[model samples]
Target: MFKRSTLSLGGTALCGALLASGCANHLQQRSEHEERVERKLLDHTLQVDIGEPKSLELPQRRIRIHEQKTFEVTEFEVTRNYDRYTPYQPWRELYEVPLGAVAIVAGVGANILNVFMLGHLPDSVTKDWIDNGVAGINPFMNIQSHGRAQQNLASIDEVQRDRRTESTSLPWSERPVEVQAGTQSYTLTTDRSGVLRLSLLDSPFAEQDLSHVMRLRISVEDDQDNVRSDISLPISGSLRGKLLEAHALIYDDLEDDDVSQWVHRVKRLSELGLEEEASELEQSLIELTHNDPELQKQFLKSLTRDAGRLVADPQASN
Candidate 1:
């Protein structure tokens, strides 16, 4: 009976040792899993957007010149190109005159007279104006009257670029994360904001611009361990380079617009050594061509048919 008891005690001790070993192994695995999750979150922080683009609009004036009874051409004029808007008034009123009141008043009167005859005022004592009158519009005119109408067009081209998002956080979940958007489902971790962010797992656009739209979701899980709902949000891409500027001209075109006007504007910009502006216009043309195959065909056909008139001849514009 003592031998049997000894054997039973040995068996119980072996069982206890086995349970302790199993517990250690389980704890190690849980620790390793947590470490891997931490590393993954760190790596995915680079995937968040810099920021959303802001919308910008500039006031423009259209001029139609009738040369001869049979011919007319349209020209575009930007109201102001200065970084900021300034109030218009007499020079004396805008700036302190170094000279006495009599000289200041005389100078102010002359400046006002020049504006009436020459269509523009002298630079204020406080501000210097860079005139683009050749491009159109007298630089000054807070002329105390005239109401301007600003339109917020509900078109895709009206959007502009602004600051980008700098950083974002990753989500922490115990189970394998499942993200659902509408009828579709994807597995992804959440960000600090509790939003599931998608990463371009492979750096396909490492060299090129990662300009693409993303569709994200807000997911809810049910008691049965199934996704109940995924409210989707479609995010637009950031606007960069001259593409952002092209949108303004694209939206400005009308149904009966003439291609020659674009060609002429581009030509003038090039002549003035405004390489950036010229490039923007050219890019706009290329984009418009890509959007409409028939337009592309027609544009190319015209280039070939009127090569001399469109490009080579000095007095070729119609």
Candidate 2:
């Protein structure tokens, strides 16, 4: 009975040990699998969030003016009819004159007498009658007002117009990289698994506030150290989940000075036979000047001139 009990106890211990070992192995395998999946995602994915373009409202104001006035005149005529009264002169009655002629003579005599009386009238009375006509004296001299309708337009924050909305893809993890937009530039690198990363030096957005959306063009170097074609794209959150991502290195508003510097840089790059770099700069120039036809034309002219010089003097450039 004692041997059987010992045997049963040993069997139970063996079974428990096997179960514990199996559980540990399973956990290790699961951990390894999870790590592999994570590495794979990092190698294959690149994510980005481009920012929206900034803008501002323009200035506006309202003003109004009003005026109202009225005037009137009246005239009175006084007449004495000689026909209504018998002539005071009895001798004049001796001649039977036409009644109409007598009335006309009386009117003429009355008008002449009134004019003589007016000439003798005081200067103030005569001036009052001449100046005022039938209406009361003029109520206003020259109307003068110093006050003006006033308004103030608020100062508006300048908007960024040269920025554009663009989207594209890049094999960022495959090589060393360069990206340029406006005056900003970014350098990139990748891990062994091809996960892309930005370099701190000459990075446009390193210290700037990152936008969820950004405009950029990506360039990469292959194994041969040759730059590949540029990839233009917007780095934005709308894209479905991805393991890797890149962004523009700019946050502040782009200015004319920045564009001028970019132009100078493009010319310098072209002069040295760096065609890929110059091409990247040209693409950025086109984007910046896209909305202004004249500016675009001027930039293209500069590019053409520099390109011609480069082609004509390759050895000199070298």
Candidate 3:
């Protein structure tokens, strides 16, 4: 009986030892698995320090000045280039004068002369005199008169006529046209052949962030007449969605219309929680082009060169 009891005690001790060893092995495996999962999670997550978006700054304007001179003694030509000058000087004048003071004086003199000579001036002339200067000086009158001028200018025909009548009409062909929205600005130009070109005047955003799908509406007008209809094109999509989805609606071809489309896409992406994915896709599309020669050439031709340049720049990365 004593020997049997001893054997039973030995069996119990061996079973307990095996169970403890098994438990330890299981716990160690679980710990190793957890460590591996943590490492993988850390590896997949992007580690980036995204600073505040930089504000867009406009580039300095380039101006070319030319001089013409005629001499009777000799038919010699002398050419000199001068930098562009601003009407306002850096230094403050001793007697500070507000803008349009001269115009105001001239306008008042003309009104007085007309009233004295004609005994009564025409309503249009009277209104012009008031709107031009006399009214502008008074805050209340300025608002009323400026409203009328804006109304008159809103019409295409009236704007064209005003430009022709006013000696201050800008030379649209020679002038550099640009538009600003939020932090971005775009410069527009037309070649001799009349092909429109657009460039980014200021771009402080990451190129990848700019790759969301966009719609552009372009319209051309000449002499107060519609020369061309509006064109809507979808652009700057991810590599997977290169083509812009078609829309049946037709809007005006103003640049503002294109801006509206950009806003719409951004809103949609934000709602979907796919903003990061969209940015990544754009980056991938940019990288892929460099690997494929045919794609690089085709992309440059189809897409505007400016788009290609923005995507290609290494500095454009966040």
Candidates' lDDT values, in order?
Answer: 0.36, 0.38, 0.33
Write candidate 1's Cα lDDT for 135-181 as tens digits: 11222222211132122222221122232233333323222345433
lDDT of 2 by residue, 289-312 (tens): 667767666656655664442222
lDDT of 3 by residue, 1-318 (tens): 999999999999987665333211000011111111111111111111111222211111221211112222212222322222112222212122232354467656777878777847664554454444533343222212222221111111111111111112122243233333234544455444333333221232222223342433333333332222333333323421321121101112323433334334333433343444334433444455566666545543433332222334432343
Best by TM-score: 2
Error of 2 at 152 (Å): 93
TM-score of each: 0.18, 0.21, 0.17
What's the ranking of the predictions by lDDT, best on top?
2, 1, 3
Model 1 TM-score is 0.18
Name the runs in model 3 displaced over 4 angstroms: 1-187, 199-209, 226-228, 239-318
Question: Which 10-residue window in model 3 sums to the lowest lDDT?
Answer: 24-33
Could you tell me the TM-score of candidate 3? 0.17
Question: Over all chains combined, what TM-score does candidate 2 have?
Answer: 0.21
Clashing pairs in 3: none
